[model samples]
Target: MSSVVVVVVGGGASGLTAALELKKSASAYYTSPITVLVMEASSRLGGRILPCDVPVEYESIGGGVLYERVQLGAEYVHGGEHLLDVFLSQKNIKRIPACVAAQGDGGPSGFQESQATVAYYCGKRKTFIRFQPDNTSSTEPWLANLNAHLRSLADDSNATSSAATTGKSVADGLPRDSFSREMADAGYGNTLAAGSCTLLDEGETRIMEVAWDKQASGDATPEGGMSRVIEELAADVCDAIRLNHYVHTIARDAETNRIRVGYVASYAHPDDANSAVPEEHANEILVDAVIYTGSLPSLAHVDVSPPLPKVVIEAARGSSHSPVAFASEAIKAAVIVRGCPYGEDSDTDLHAVICSNSLWPEISFRRAKVGDNLWVCGGFVSGTCAEDLKSACISRAGAARWRNETCVVLLEQLDSMFGDGGKGWRASAGQLIGDHDAEVVPPSNRVVGAAAYAWGSDPHARGGYTFPRLPGASHVRASLNAALWPDVRAPPFFLAGEACGDDDGAPMTVHAAMESGRRAARRAIASIAGRGTLQSRM
Candidate 1:
């Protein structure tokens, strides 16, 4: 009996997990050795899970090299269950409950002094309304609108097929997913409203609302960062990963009944700079099965000879081509700043500041694990689609310039909220940012450094995450996950990623992506085992 050669493409969370799962199951599930290969397009793994170091001074905590590990993606453990939370628990990792502070739009102060409060900024009147969740009467109107929206969404889900055939857009649906409209009607601006609706699907939005109601929060990163999970997962499959291998094509080899994968060497090894290997020259590999964990956009661009089933192609195409429909684009900016902005007697324990403005819907500030003087503050900006958001991060001036602009905006907002009434802190912040025409704006001592990234701009990623808009998306995902016709003599091929799940309860999440990979790996194994059993019988 020959070993089954399985190739996992895209060494992100899903691909790595699939490879690890397949390796761990070698003895239990197969009679022969199973060879697993993980091909990553980028020089590094972890996909959208990016972590960077922010310098912090640790004078209070014994004065060591204290730097805060800030996460640029997948920050929270949503619901605190599933494989991610379990892994964290097993590793004895700690999760910090996020506390939120919000300032109403056009409020006298850009930020409020109170913590754990929800402030709605009225774009029309330019006033802020602070809502107390405990006050049933005050919150009844918003709750009513939310309940109504959910009912409408449920109705739309039931009638989606008929509506789609009738040429109805998502806007025509019963619930209609107008988060901004709903929020604006409730006196809050489109900033928070759009932010919520754009990031999550209808079902996910509902779940989040429930979680918010409970106030029983999910956890943020452990002390260092969320990269530990990636490091651990990659460690298990490190030997199998082929970094900087950009897969451009996947084809079925009719003669050998194997899958032919074509990829180009995307980068140069530091030691082999003198080597004359052309990066453009395509390399080929033959595998018994393939688990594609690449992004939807990357999958769309791949040349599939003897095209995949129409359903699979349609699903991938729908995800990639429809930039405005299914997915959301976002830019995250992290700024390293000095001084204590909010706390008791200038010692603020504030973790996050939710804004009603469009520039930064939410700004989070967290103290460094080791450094008492350093803090990392980040703001998330949601755009209408891929192009809109990508431009904000990847500008003609370059990412660094965009990052500086974003940080400047953040500092300005902070000046409004925390400034000493246009004198004390504001004067210091202006000096730090420097004048607009200064050619090179030096960061004042108060502002250490700033960095920004838009995941949609990444060559491999092409988008932040999946957010299925219409009801038909589930069917498409199911088709993508389904194996090709068993009667066909083609090679075994499977699709797995954040966008490959059919479950509405768990979609567009790290755990869901991992689950999808595990499922795909199992299917690939079963296909191989079934073929082996049939060959033996023959």
Candidate 2:
């Protein structure tokens, strides 16, 4: 029996999932044996789901050391009952509710509680405002009114058509209040000016996509981190993954009637400390099918012989489609500080605090226990804020400078928010330790370990994820989903990624990526079977 070979490019959540799905289900669809190969450009397997251990040492607190596992990339499982949830459940991974309330059964699977204590800091007021989950407090009638207005807007957007909402943005309809704009930014991961309302209504939506259904209660963080999910997906197909293999070209092999994948393999020099002087070797492989699971913008770097379909290329480039998908910038930073920053009266169980009118476009902080009197405070900034940060970093130097600057900013923000009059704690530049290293001596009431990641600057990802802009049409994603050779009954080239998600109402998430991968695998298997049938008939 003749064997079939399938090449999965970009070993991210989607790519690895595609390879694994092909390996498991190919036999049922195709009569011949199927061989799956995963080409990962980066040195690591989890493309954007990077989890690292930052070493922390505090001599002031008995002089012990610990490694804090921090997720530098994708962290939360936005919704439940998806492929990711199933994987987590199957792996027996712990699921920590992202939100919890001080009262009332924690409000709809603890989401209500999360919403109740959402502390918003007003830079203008120089104070924090908490919106009670239940709007019974007449003291803040405007808060309840604003919440109602926002809900009404969401409903109206849902009722309206894409054409009617075209050229409109979330900011366009938002109340002319800084807090309102910040709330929108926190949800959409983009500035109100750039976040398209039409896309949210008709195109892909984020956590707000689906209502509070049984399947999707609310967001949750996996116990071990998102890396666990990646590990689970790649467990069986570990041998198939080729890290540091950059696929530069996918062309048709006229002689064999198969797809030829050309890549460059990087080998680190034995004596190089920085591995900057690595050797590059060009390689090629012939495969029956190819699944390109990279981001849309990344397509620009890949050379496809004879070119992909015009519509597909257009969609990838965001040239033809109005309100096309754009790469979004999101930065995440975390620091291990001494003592609980929230104070004794503050809600210790608080999940996250969304800050408005702050240094960044939209910043949110979450606290997790690291050890006795040691807490890890993590902050997230995205949308316009992240873009500005990226630009600033580029203007100054590079990502390293960005990380250093972000660490300092995060420390300052934390101090301003938690530190009384910005004096509760101070940042120790001398004692701050990198992800790998640990400082022997600890400073009093200072940050010991700090780490930050700018997903937009990451070469492998290009950006945090894809989001639609104003005047966008839902058909753009459909165009992105088009096969390389749609006219062919058994096209050899296909595309799958979070960006390719269609009108499923699912946002660009890990589950969506996995689903796309599975879909691509099914198409590849069917195409392989169809090709075999055509050959036999000929």
Candidate 3:
């Protein structure tokens, strides 16, 4: 038996998974030995799953410098036995259940506590809604609508319709007018009305709701950084992965008829000034099959020889029905904080605070795995552009400005909800337990350092896992899996990524990426076997 050479483009979750899956299923599917290769454009293997390490010195608290790893990209396991979750559990990584808290007034005292409560501010009065486990009736208006939308999507009929229509907006099926009326009837505030109105597209919200449901079932990150998972997945195929090999173009060989992948020798070293200059056409490799796992935004920039099919191109760019998910810019910023805002004894709440009137949508407080009396505040930004968000993440000047502004806004919001000294409190047991004696760490003292990440800014990963911008996004996603060439003998190129919504059960998620990769790899292997090309080496 001869060897079948396979190349996987992009070293993200999908690409890595595809390579591994190819290796696993090779024996059964291929008549000969299979060689799997993964080409990564960036210097690192993990694409969007980045762990930004911050050195925090706890010398004052009797400890050394602890390198706290914060998630800048994909954080939180969306629960269930998805690929990531299964891997973590098998590796015996601890999974912590996330607790959600809302802000409410502490009686007359201005200090409000963030514990086991879901608070919403309406007009001048602060309303508190205690979180009850297994209770669904009291779900927030936004959450209720989201749940209903997910239900509709889960139905086979609706899902099939969505998969066929590639140019319809989500608003067409799930009208915003109906959603707004329901929220108004439920008595939600103006701020929430505006925020939830544009939270996500109707179908996009359905996907998010599915994730949130998993979180409620205890979505959590392992004790170590998420990059650890990537490391584990790449363990067996470490030798096959070529880091900093940015692919510029892909085409089929004219004579050999094999696939030829063209890439530049990218330098990973930060000090290396030559990293910016692409050694034009410096490197090329020919493979029997290529599984492209790069994101949609990334593929749009790369030139494909002989040109890709119109449907594939439309999926790469954006269609009227499937507006690019990248359009909804996502920005996450994290800052090291001293003194637990929820108190020392507060149970681990994945999401510590939900503020109705604040610049940040929400902030999660995590107890540092390495340091004591250490916590971090982080959240996503809404109504921001990709360029502005990207600038805040990359440029030094932009980062400094972003940090100061975020810290200031966070302090004001926290004080408004928890500064009990300014307001009176009802003296009743379990009514309002004011921890006034506890030292209130000022923003200056509490905020040791901060960092930000803008997914839209990344050149290799322009869009952080895609979402449905419009109703027909699902159809666009499905098109990615369709054959680029009209003949079905065997496609030279196969697509895999979160954007490939072939698996309707999981789209725009790690599970979807892995699933798509497996699907593409299997198809590629089967194609080679069917064509009887495995007998000869390319």
On TM-score, the leading prediction is 2
Model 1 lDDT, residue 237, Cα: 84
lDDT for each residue of candidate 3 in 1-538, tens digit (9 for 90 to 100): 5567898998877888888888877755445788888989778887768888876656655655567788877665544666667767777777654444211111101112223233332212333233333443465454444334444544434443243433433334444545323322122111112233334344443443333333344445556766777777898678779888777778878788788888777544243221343547868888788888887766776778778877667656745444444443556667666656555666544453444434454556676665556677666553333234344433532543444344444444555555534321111101011122334443234545456665555667664456444446556666777656545467778888877744334345566677788888888887777677764333
TM-score of 1: 0.75
Judge candidate 2 at residue 477 and give its lDDT. Answer: 60
- Model 2 per-residue lDDT tens digits across residues 1-538: 6667899998888899899888877654445577788988778888768887877775646887778887887776765667777878888988876662111011223555243244556554556655565652475554554454444543444432144443455444556664554454444444322332334432222223222222335567787788888888888799788888778788988898898888887722232111232233358888899999987766766788878776666645656463455545778877776656666444444445655555443343445446556667666666565776666655544544656666666666666766544443433534353312222234444676778887766666666566444324355566666677765667899898877653443456687788878889888877887776322222
TM-score against truth, every candidate: 0.75, 0.83, 0.75
Looking at model 2, report the run of 10 residues with the lowest lDDT sum. Answer: 100-109
| Candidate 1 Cα deviation (angstroms), residue 210 | 8.2
Q: How much is 259 displaced in model 2, in angstroms? A: 0.1
Better by lDDT, candidate 2 or 1: 2
TM-score ranking, high to low: 2, 1, 3
Q: Model 1: which residue pairs collide? A: 105-121, 342-348, 343-347, 343-348, 432-444
Task: Please give the lDDT score at residue 61 for candidate 3.
Answer: 59
Name the candidate that leads on lDDT. Answer: 2
Q: What is the lDDT of candidate 3?
A: 0.56
Candidates in order have lDDT scores of 0.57, 0.62, 0.56
Q: Which ten residues in a row have the lowest lDDT in candidate 1?
A: 102-111
